[model samples]
Target: MRLIAPFLLLAALPAFAADPTPEITRPAGTPQANGVVHTLRQIPEACARIEGAFTGQAAEPYRFAVVRTSQNCQPRARFVDFDKAKPSEAAGWKFNDLIRVPSAACPSQQAVVRVWRKPVDVGQERDGQGQSRIYLDDAMKTAAAGKLPAIPMYAAAMSVEGKACP
Candidate 1:
């Protein structure tokens, strides 16, 4: 009876277990790298991704740019809103507040720069040891192919002055 009770308890435990977190699947054409790509809050209607490269330099370690997921799909939102008033540092990178940048698609609306850093090394040691090297190499290939290196960080859009969509 003792052994049977233990088995029954174990079986019931799973029924009461908490639900697992949903897995976020990366969109097609997401840049592959050794380091982890932190998930960003996304605009439900808009599709976007973080595009940039690892310079592998001290003066300018990381360069990030937000772009649309597809050229044909024009989202109403222009810029990403991190909901931050000031820059925050994490994992050797400085996540900046919303900074407007010129947008070719929407001339009146400015795009936002969610992150930027000029850290020396950007703590390569912390990036999965030797992963940064692999990223640099992959970045070069992406650039050569006439495509900017990109990750799966989808930016949450912020509507600016003007009609949201053309």
Candidate 2:
């Protein structure tokens, strides 16, 4: 029985080594290395009021991404209201002059969202780690602005009037 116990322990050791998990390290502000990078400017009051309405609901889901220009990291923002945003119909478009904010009701005050470099799995570029995340907020006294920081979900984010919202 003693000899059997030692053999069983030795066999289990190999299983543990075979399934080693990769550790994820997240830092403040920008991510280290190839992780997600979110650049949030102070969210304006108008934009925050609009996004607050859809805090819980995923009605106006936006997408954002990071791009490189002249070797400088400059984040680009675009309208990605995929649900209502249609290519042909300007009314469905989030950035068009027709589409107005449900809260502000101002087309000019509307913002744009985007999705950054999404983590690829089993492809030319695969970051076995989980997806990168980002978030956006305003000067509201609400929870979405305070309680739990609403960071952007990995590669997706939104921008309006030059402010980035996760």
Candidate 3:
């Protein structure tokens, strides 16, 4: 009876612990059929899709410049610098690999690209009225899967800052 009681207590302890949230996978820089390299950006209230072209070699330590392709997008989130440094587990964001993107201005049709993501905070996930706020991580996954357009308009929007191709 003593051994059984201890096992039951251990099983119940898991219920009191918070469920672990899934981590978002790093985004890739693969371009879509329309020649647009789609990626995600963390906005104030939601995750946004940003289109851009790679500007250098398709290797580590690349740079991605934001381009203005859509009318419905956030304008402030611009520029991503991907470095070769190791990603820090303690930091909210980490460095990811470089990818090839289509670029017109660049000598080569392809350009180098890298991605960085910021960790989502628990408090920011909910609003004062207890309503859910951001869906950045989910949008990021969708973008990586090459299905950014399928996401609901409210959950994600288009974002652009400058012209990466021109």
Candidate 4:
């Protein structure tokens, strides 16, 4: 009876397997995105609307790239926190890879989900500050909550394995 009981328990147990490699998917007409996470900032005003909030750079130890000051919109060089090859000196806070979801911009609803990981080099976990998940859906909600200028929350959103996350 003991042997049979063990067999039954094993049969009833859920399979514990490692997460499979994510299959990246881009919707039709979605352009190839560079590492750049662009922002629609007021040309002469903000270098970036809220760069520290996104990408991977901390508010400190950061620089601006503005070659043509007269242009309305242009690409700028943003900083990164980690490389998996070259780690950042300021490692207190870091951004996980941008995960594209779906948004209202496209006919198909896809948005992106981004998160902050404080203390990148620390073992296991990080500090609570700047350590919450950021979702494009939430950004949409924020934008919708008020009336005025509506800046885009993300450059793009994608789907993988038929799921709603990047």
Candidate 5:
């Protein structure tokens, strides 16, 4: 039968494959850095809203990281959005916050600077190569912001919001 129909279409092509990209597991005092030093501000009591570091989302399903002081803000250099953020405390190494952006749209500068961290990797969910391996756990449920796919498993990112307030 034509060589068993090409071995049954290559054994059913592994059941159609193509489904395995959902990860973000790395939270437990997450601080192992060859780089991690942050500073930036523009809170001005909220309305200014340009904090610095981490963005939003929390509970369990992780994704956190931010470093866009400028470049017009838009993926200018990249660090994407790590699946949408979650680990702030599912057990241990909780991170995710700061790097605010509002000031009407994008106009940073309340003063305070110190950026330099360039090694990232979280657990097991990489995409497109930019590098993302998220793996942190604990919350069980709560992190629900865009769901997932923003892509940004952390390995370095820490912030402090003080200077500008002076």
Candidate 6:
């Protein structure tokens, strides 16, 4: 009985210390992201296709994006509004860092999730509306919607149009 007590205690020890699983750690730039929430107005020409009641005749779609444009409204070189603005003073809106979203194309479409980012452009202009227009094409829209990587103002300019981004 001299050493039987110590031997029994060692045999009773559990294999894993009976502790919980450890959390998985990720890389620095990569982080868990929240869904993007904002009001999206379809371009007037494309509005009719999107059937829904919005503030204006244009349709409003609430979609998720990997990288969301900042909610803060940044002034475009101090324009009184969109009107009476000079083209030289126009600038693009800065968005949050890249993120993951459910889809990229249309709200009706079920596509693989994607990641994207929108680079700010201070020299791009569209529709002759100066600061009133922020333009993006299908591809750029894909990025803004979180389909691709961070794009420059030039590429993003092709994807989005109107004052939406700014």
Candidate 5, run of 10 with poorest lDDT: 102-111
Tens digit of lDDT per residue, candidate 5, span 25-104? 22222221212223333222112222233222122112223434444444312232322432333323223332322221
lDDT of 2 by residue, 7-67 (tens): 9999889856732232222222221111223333222211211121222113442323333
Candidate 6: tens digits of C-alpha lDDT, residues 42-89: 122112111111112123322322222334534222112112321121
* Model 2 residue 22 lDDT score: 23
lDDT of each: 0.41, 0.31, 0.40, 0.32, 0.31, 0.27
Give the TM-score of each candidate. 0.25, 0.18, 0.28, 0.20, 0.16, 0.15
Could you tell me how far off, in angstroms, the CA of residue 83 lies in candidate 1 after the best superposition? 12
Please, what are the lDDT tens digits per residue for candidate 3 over residues 1-166? 8889989989988854522222433343444333334553433322233445343333321233444445665443433333433234355453333334444444234443334444344433567898976578986996899863421111111122223342
Q: Candidate 6: which stretches are off by over 4 Å? A: 1-35, 38-58, 61-79, 89-166
* Cand. 3 TM to true fold: 0.28
Which residue pairs in model 3 clash with each other? 73-158
lDDT of 1 at 132: 54
- Residue 145's lDDT in candidate 4: 86
Candidate 4 lDDT for residue 33: 29
Report the candidate with higher TM-score, 2 versus 6: 2
| Candidate 1 minimal-lDDT segment of 10 residues | 19-28
RMSD of each: 20.9, 23.3, 18.6, 18.5, 22.7, 21.4
1-166: candidate 4 lDDT, tens digit per residue: 8789998877756532221222333333232222334331222222224221122222221122222334564433332222332322254333323444322222233233332333322222334775645467875886798833322121211222122222
| Range of the 10 consecutive residues with the lowest summed lDDT in candidate 4 | 152-161
Name the lDDT value of residue 126 in candidate 4.
36
